[model samples]
Target: MAGRNMNVYFQEETYSKIKNLVAKREISRFINEAVEEKLKQRQQQQKEELRKKLIVGYQSRIKNKKLQKILLTYGEMSWEDLSAKLEEQEKNDDNCKK
Candidate 1:
């Protein structure tokens, strides 16, 4: 791969520590690899966040669809029919309590 020359500033103490930790020739390579790894981690975290958002959106749509189905079922009923259904459900609940 082609490389470009760029100047980077580091704190004196940090730079001294890094110099102590790595050979002079491999410092740039080490920094490059560390940056690449960090970038990959950031990209993976972004993908996971998007996946979670998609899952939540999908679940919301499913919930809305279920709500729509329930509304559609009851929307066709007359007030008297709804009242009768409510009364029947109440009776069933009363029975279940016994």
Candidate 2:
């Protein structure tokens, strides 16, 4: 509380809502608690989004490996190309692990 000073402008209806919520209690404390809870919710949402992206990427990788196997069996690609691709994939995996 002592470390922050900020201004926020709200519509009349929104201001009224906030006042109504704290009409029978300490307004400052109520607002502080509400803001804290909202920040926590935002942080949690960001974490969940990152987790979902990682899961999708992992699934897509498995699909790519399957396709590569099919192509290799049909002799549609060269060993040199396959080896290079494997090296690139390894690099990406190492980056993700870090």
In terms of lDDT, model 2 sits at 0.84
Per-residue C-alpha lDDT of model 2 across residues 11-72, encoded as one tens digit per residue = 99988988877675676677688899999999999999999999999999887997879877
Candidate 2 regions with alpha-carbon error over 4 angstroms = 23-25, 67-98
Candidate 2 lDDT score at position 26: 79
Task: Give TM-scores for every candidate, taking all chains together and pairing residue i with residue i.
Answer: 0.66, 0.56
Please write out the lDDT profile of model 1 over residues 11-94, one tens digit for every residue: 999999999999999999999999899999999999999999999999999879978998998999999999999999999999
Kindly provide the TM-score of model 1 when superposed on the true structure, using C-alpha atoms.
0.66
lDDT of 1 at 7: 95
The root-mean-square deviation over C-alpha atoms between each candidate and the true structure, in angstroms, is 6.0, 13.9
